[model samples]
Target: MVATTGRGRQGRGRQKIEMKPIQKETARQVCFSKRCAGVFKKASELSVLCGAEIAVLAFSPSSKPFSYGHPSVESILERFFGSSADAAPATPPRHPPAAVLIQALGRQEKELQERLEAGKRRKAALEESLRGPQWGPVGDLLGAWRS
Candidate 1:
């Protein structure tokens, strides 16, 4: 039965797009977001259907982690690996105060600036010492200065 045409498309022309690497970074990120959501949804469905304890952890191209876990990852890991893996660092709250963060950052920046200036002074002293014998020997000089 060589009756030509009609592969159930109502005689419409269909263009087959070859899967290729996305050129633009933004476009790739958007595509990754869409596809990551789709995959997570599928994983959720599969876990529900098969009644299986499952986990899927993925990293985006930018190295950000995205994960899906059924019946809690902590419980599942405890059942298999051990409870030791549950020693996670304390997480920040859902929202933090901007003023508090800014103040903390300011304090850190000031401390770092002071340290940097101290380091620069130490470096200059070392360089000056290296320039001539008048600055004297270099045996534990920095340590001596610290004391």
Candidate 2:
């Protein structure tokens, strides 16, 4: 079996091991403990190096909770989960002027009505055309108007 080490500088001192089923379980527990400690250590190092607050939480294989924070966990928790007083309440979006909206609606309605009437006329013309010589006289009249 191949062994794989953890990533990052925090994992520098740790070594990977290969083992069987029972040994794998033991190795897993040991790795988890070491990695968890490394994670907390890195968090602490980051907070100190950057002068930034940090919080971390993890649960072990046994379901026991572990946590770490710089400058108090509650402060970080409050900053994370608490709402700021400076935040503005969300407001409904404003619309265009009522006059402009009404005008646009009226223009759209007129265009749609014109299109409907033109479609009806086109359908009637097609039906007449399909009826053969019944539309001959109308066609002749329109041909004369075109001339």
Candidate 3:
């Protein structure tokens, strides 16, 4: 036998909640926690999907603060405030610090050089193998094969 309740098999799915203040303190705190989590999740998604930098600051009914940020709140706040300060540069830097960039470029250059040397060594070994008495040159080997 199929089980059925007065409200149907599954009670009213999701219902639209009225947007207003919750009177109960415990309920309001719960709601605040849940909503803050949801807001943070959306902020994270926005940051990942659109590469957006976002910082969220929220205060609960009790006056406690909640915060969210892409990268870090401090960094975002620094960038925001630093850009406005009189002593700060007219424009924020477009790239990483010069020393960091130089180090990264140096590592990449070294890796590329290593790859080049390895490729040269491979080519030399292959050429040496092909010069054996049985093989002769690549052109001659192809010619002999075709015949």
Candidate 4:
């Protein structure tokens, strides 16, 4: 068998290509799809391991939109608004009309209240579980077993 020569300029053979921006249309499209999938996968792993809420919005080269959210994009966005509103100053920003500002603040407030109630309920359940008689006193366990 004859030995093959070195890589040609067209790169017909697989040569180490640069990681720079892809110039060719077809190659760029393929790269975009692959990279987007990788980004979403990494984001999923990050949220699962860290218990983090994440939301991602991406626009493809063709102006197509895509999204990835752990839990949900809406929930994460609502939490963000609730946290931001909590830290906001008394004076509302001048850009948006007062009516819009008031409406947004009201929504954020409602969401914050719901979140707080949920937390309180969870705490109550946990506390009640701790007080349960599942594994009462060791002496009681021994006495009951003996009887």
Candidate 5:
């Protein structure tokens, strides 16, 4: 956790540090930078020490981007967001509505039926071609040799 010294002129301890607006702004910025670095360091250490993949993204006070990750940020994000194919199952299956299941099965059945019909048509066309007039010339030549 990042610690911050309170703002304003009133606080515990002697007035060794003057709490002016400029000084306050400077201290805040410095604290922010330090904390950002600390957080990234901690994240990297945690990933290494525990053998856990981690990704840390921090935006600076100036809106700049900074990031650190173990074994690449893309893999870490993929693991977290279910984009990795090798990632283990993280959630149990939910029971879907029967109506929805029936609708999905119906759609699948329709698709399979269409494919079967197409396949039958293709087979019929192929068989018809093999048995049609196109084979007559070859058959006549072969028949002549047989005769």
Candidate 6:
């Protein structure tokens, strides 16, 4: 049997990285470029596979903006905001007047706000669960455990 040296294969495998800001500017730029490309690729794949509209905006270390959007960024933004500048004025309203449209939009906004609040609550509960139990005293723990 041949003796094996631990050092031989140790550095060749993947290692868990500590989550922290990269110090060197060059390394940070390289990492940013690679990660940005990877994210954009994933976004593209998700859009294609799920038929979902997507828009991604990112800023580099130098404060330059990068964006990717399916079916054009401007079109997506217009759709999201429910406004379009180039829309033909000659086209007759399929629905009613501006007041009805405004009312409908208000209702939609309210519904979206309610959903947002619910999602925030859910997120907070999940975060609390992940943090485990927090007890000030034995009484608190017992009270929580019992109920």
Give per-model CA RMSD: 19.1, 18.5, 10.3, 16.3, 21.3, 19.7
* Cα lDDT of model 3 by residue, 100-127, tens digit: 9999999999999999999999999999
Clashing pairs in 5: none
Candidate 6 colliding pairs: none
* Tens digit of per-residue lDDT, candidate 5, span 1-147: 333466644445544646454346677678768878899889888877886667888776667887887767775676688866877644333358899999999999999999999999999999999887775889789888999
The top-ranked prediction according to lDDT is 3
> For candidate 1, which ten residues in a row score worst on lDDT?
86-95
Angstrom error of the Cα, residue 29, model 6: value is 0.9
**lDDT, residue 62, candidate 5:** 61
TM-score of 2: 0.42
Error of 5 at 15 (Å): 14
Ranking, TM-score, top scorer first = 3, 6, 4, 1, 2, 5
Candidate 3 shows a clash count of 0
Model 5 segments more than 4 A misplaced: 1-25, 83-147
Off by over 4 Å in 6: 1-13, 83-147
Best by TM-score: 3
Q: What are the lDDT figures for the candidates, one per model?
A: 0.76, 0.78, 0.84, 0.80, 0.76, 0.80
Better model by lDDT, 1 or 6? 6
The C-alpha TM-scores of every prediction are 0.42, 0.42, 0.50, 0.44, 0.38, 0.47
Candidate 1 global CA lDDT score: 0.76
lDDT of 1 by residue, 1-147 (tens): 233465643443566667999989999899999999999899899878886776777798799998887766655555567556556423233346999899999999999999999999999999987885654456458558879
- Alpha carbon lDDT at 117, candidate 6: 100
Better of 4 and 6 by TM-score: 6
lDDT-best of 3 and 4: 3
Give lDDT tens digits, candidate 6, residues 31-131.
99999999999999988888667788899998889888875566566666665666643324334999988999999999999999999999999998778
| Residue 110 accuracy (lDDT) in model 6 | 100
Note the residue pairs that clash in candidate 1: none
Residue 5: error of model 6 in Å?
Answer: 12
Report clash pairs, candidate 2. none
lDDT tens digits, residues 10-60, model 2?
433456655544346676688779989999999999988886778898997
